[model samples]
Target: MHFLNRGRKLVRTAIALAATIALAGGGVTATADRASAAPVTPSPIAQAGTAAVKGSAKDGYQVYSRTSEAIRYTRTYDGIRVYGGDLIVRLKNGKVTGTSVGLAKPLSLSTKPSVTALSARAKATSAFRGKITSSGTPELFVDASDGTGKLAWETVISGWQPDGQTPSRLHVITDALTGAVRGSFDEIESVSGTGNSIYSGPVAIETTANDTGFSLTDPVRGGGYTCDMGNRTSGTCAVFTDDDNLWGTGANADRASAAVDAHFGAATTFDYFKNVHGRDGIFGTGVGVPSRVHYGSAYVNAFWDGAQMTYGDGSGNAKPLVALDVAGHEMSHGVTEHVVPGGLTYAGEPGGLNEATSDIFGSMVEFYANSTADAGDYDIGEKIDIRGTGAPLRYMYDPAKDGSSHGCWSTTTKNVDVHYSSGVANHFFFDLAEGTGVTAYGTSPLCGSAAPVAGVGREKASAIWFRALSNYFISSTTYAQARGYTLSAAADLYGFCGTEYKAVQASWTAVNVAGDDFCSAGNDFTLALSAPSVAVDPGTSGTVTVATTAINGDPEPITFTAGVVPAGVTVSFDPATVTAGEPTTVTVTADPGTPRSSAPVTITATAPSVTRAVSLAVSVNSSAGCTGTNGDDVAIPDNTTVTSTITIADCAVTPSSTASVEVHIVHTYIGDLVITLLAPDGTAYVLHNRAGGGTDNINQTYTVNLSAEAPNGPWVLQVRDAASADIGKIDSWSLSL
Candidate 1:
């Protein structure tokens, strides 16, 4: 299948759809469009071990900032590479500052493969539908894309496509032990999925100045250029050159005609990504990808081969496949490949997601252009008649309109072909952008009695999708994960309380994709905290708003309670129990004796069988209270020791770790003085041991932990002059419990 016109193509390319990067920071196979990567050195701590059981950066999956001095490493268990075993280390001022990891759990398995390499290769080759010209050695590796790391074999099958005109490179993944077909990545990135010919008319295109005249290259935009395939199936194609740079006559016979649409599509797609999504280029590095037009005689498809975009002239050269949306669609595949490591795997639900990503972005690009000749709409390949009939390749508003696509999800959603399974997400994106029922685009239907949804507009919807795809999505991300990540993206972009966040939840549900957490739409109520955490001093109080929204039903009585309260801390609810809807106030008070420490506090709301909870980090600050002072002075001769007692009483709790002691000693040689605190249990904690030379009095405050001792008892202050020089006296001393 190729871009937009999946079935229109004679044979599948199998390259673009097959390269899935199971792990972030992991290799994307040497031939996956990008240059072969060098083996990433692993940090000493980047191991597939128990560290991931803790669910932290220590797990080996890490994120790095481009500006930070961070080195990324991919792990290998035994001998094979551990795909998800990724981590990053950062340095500051020539010192190791921090590290993070991505492994979800420890991976410990025998590297020895039960299945032979030939057997694995056979299994992988059997899955490849195209004719094979050659096969790669079956290499062993750890497939940790699913979080459960296991031994797997990767085999590359390269050859001519079934069409015989286009080439095919299919990467098949097989389980090493079971020899079962796990997944595959194809070279052809299809939209199953438009530009002109005959579609978009009289469009402006950028060109580069050459020695003779002008080349179909946009030096202003990454130097990407369009070329003619010369009706040949293989070999390099000559770059298109024009004299006046006037180029196309708005006709396919002009040769430069289809080239005009292809070039405009690449530039428009580039602009849409840069201006709307802030992406620098197809690969985010500001580097442009080349586009080849008029590929093969009467060819019927266009594809984003890991490296470039190739468009075939339609049947009889009468209908070229270079429509604006189709161009945008093919170029989008490159963005997907570059944005997400090796790109989304081209099989099952992930493959559908990959296709839907292109379609959605392509449609958005068309909308962004809003060309007068070809007005934007939520349709794919509406201009080019790739389907023989005048119908568009796929309808975004109603994917099922094409007959094979599933508008709603089901148990077998993951098992269907990527082209058809994409219907779910395409329908969802449409609902998200235009809402359900009649709209400017088309009327959208709801699934399984889903709640009515309101549109969030294309700008917000596209932003949310791009954010999720680039940041939160992994190669194996499924519909459920997509739902969660998109909601997270919406919340990140437009706060959880806004209409945008709610629309994300509503739209996903409208397409029958359910998630655990919802912003405002569900059968039960929803709960969220205004602030995730708070800090307060002892004897003070902090308040957090507990908001609850009843979704799709009436108020279910929700009783609010604090899970665990630390010592000297009291938690109170404004209204302990209420019907879930109105916001509740949670007041946390720390007494004067509360210690300076932080702990996780869970605020739970229970109603019937539904329970919602949020964690609030409570930090209590210690106070300088409970001080016992004595103003009377004690005489101390040279080399003699004098003790002062300040009895502590009426203290409710033991002293905190930050207990303080104030000592005032007058001496000619202050270096001879030593001060200490004696607890009621006779446990002496040294405060200071003489250090000054021949100085004056020593007046200072020392902080220490007295948590283990009694709060109400005699706390003695001991001062001694170790050196026999200049007699001194203990002026005064005090103890703060």
Candidate 2:
């Protein structure tokens, strides 16, 4: 089956054709003239991955960013890059400080493709029946959505859709070596509509007056033009021409009647983005989008195929699908594709985001036009009687009104059709712009346990979404990530931790999207350790500074505690307790007979209702000598996992020998830490799993049996901080074999 056919079925099934009626009265007649068109030019192929890193850069690895302070890297093996393999390194003015990786392990994969590119293309074409207008060379891609990577083939096939009027651009991904189709989606975004001379009503449209006469082409705005397909399946469409300057009679009886709405929609959508968001045009390059009307016999849909917009005549040719929102929705698809490269994957959560993006701008365009004929509202496709009951196709205020649409987010959201899944984001945008409960637009209800949200105004909300779409979003972005990026965008446009940022957070939460509200002004206190980690040798002592600052409500006393001390180690706080804005010193002492190993310690501070933790490292050097240490400072952000590796070289041990590890960590709330030791052979031993309760710091040594294992390879000590609010780092560690 075709990818978008499912969505068409949903719309057709839900549509109640009992209330079909004429939208506007009168018809504008116009004569059509044949015009020559330039040959179609293929779109330039995008480079598969980021520019190759030079100078000692390994194959399948690329640098994501670089600055005097630090550099970020990602893995791209054999031309197929990891989707979320981002590694960030911190530097102190040019000196190396610390490093953190997005992936759990290094990327390693075979570069050879077992299936040929021709075979991949053939599979795509066979899956969907359509004339091939354009095809791109299949490229190797890695499926890394689940943290692990798998190689696959990504192919693009475009041509006339099986529905005829709706063009198709399908992206089919197949397992490179197995020839198994992993997933597929249509790139062209579309919406079904009904017939009738639909107009936003009396809007000014730009026209070009040539030597012959005036045409339905706008020379003042990106050279966009509206043409009549003449109800033919094949051949060039003629541009609408008129001897008089005025066009369209607000009725679908004449071919030029629908052109008025189509032309006006294009202009209004362009102005909305340009004036409100500072964007130049749909592609942000002042490029025009051609509009083709009257496509196919009894057609009932409109779509945007990458470069242009096409509308079909409604059932019985009595209605043209050139409604304002429909036109704006179609063109906005082009904008999204150009704004976010790869166009949001066109399936799953990303696909829902893509569709929701168009719906958002389409509604904005209607508001921008503000024509009395079709008053601006949150209702989508309301003017078009596609549902036959005079009801809109989807309601942003309550998506469930359409039956199939999801009013809120859930785990199964991505499994639904993009159009239905889009309801979650659409509702989010509405709530963000208009708040919950009664409003000028409509009443919005909260999802799950979300609190009622206050509107940030459509103007500011649209700006935040546009900024995120243009600058922050990626093809595989999830709804949770959308919340983060939008928050980031709001921060960039307004200010961090401001009202705008708070509204963005509240809006997403109202749609049941779980995210951190870091900008919230409710935090009572801030906790930090003077250093990321500390190192202490056997028979020696190390001290770290624990600082607490007042925020929101303060001046409360904070009690200090210790967590997971080594067998031969003891930890104590100099001031044990202090009020907010005071600093305390944590002293960790190791016994002279301490075993040669690494131990992780945690320090926690607790007030009336606020508690935080940091991690520290304690190492006991082997009296026999052969140990390595890493003192790099790693930042463990809240609710994230981070790893620090210590390599022990030139060390050999017997096969049946036991190994000792000394780990030191400086973090708040050791109870939230999960530390593990990963050997070279992939054997992992859990050192600590929130074992310290509410105590803080990990200054301990662990002894593990290394029998039947090799002891001369890189060992990794992984530390994960699994809760919110508390954060710390892996200070240093030593290994003895």
**Full-model lDDT for every candidate:** 0.70, 0.67
Clashes of each: 28, 43
How much RMSD separates candidate 2 from the native structure? 18.0
User: TM-scores of all models?
Assistant: 0.62, 0.61
Cα RMSD for candidates in order: 27.8, 18.0
Candidate 2 Cα outliers beyond 4 Å, as residue runs = 1-106, 129-137, 143-148, 158-160, 193-197, 519-737
Please list the residue runs of candidate 1 whose C-alpha ends up more than 4 Å from where it truly belongs after superposition. 1-76, 83-104, 191-197, 519-610, 613-737
> On a 0 to 100 scale, what is the lDDT of residue 106 in model 2?
33
Q: State the weakest 10-residue window (summed lDDT) of model 1.
A: 15-24
Q: lDDT per residue, candidate 1, 15-100, as tens digits?
A: 10000000001123221111124765433233212222212222233332232344444455764566645444344443333333
In model 1, the Cα lDDT at residue 63 comes to 32
For model 1, the local distance difference test gives 0.70
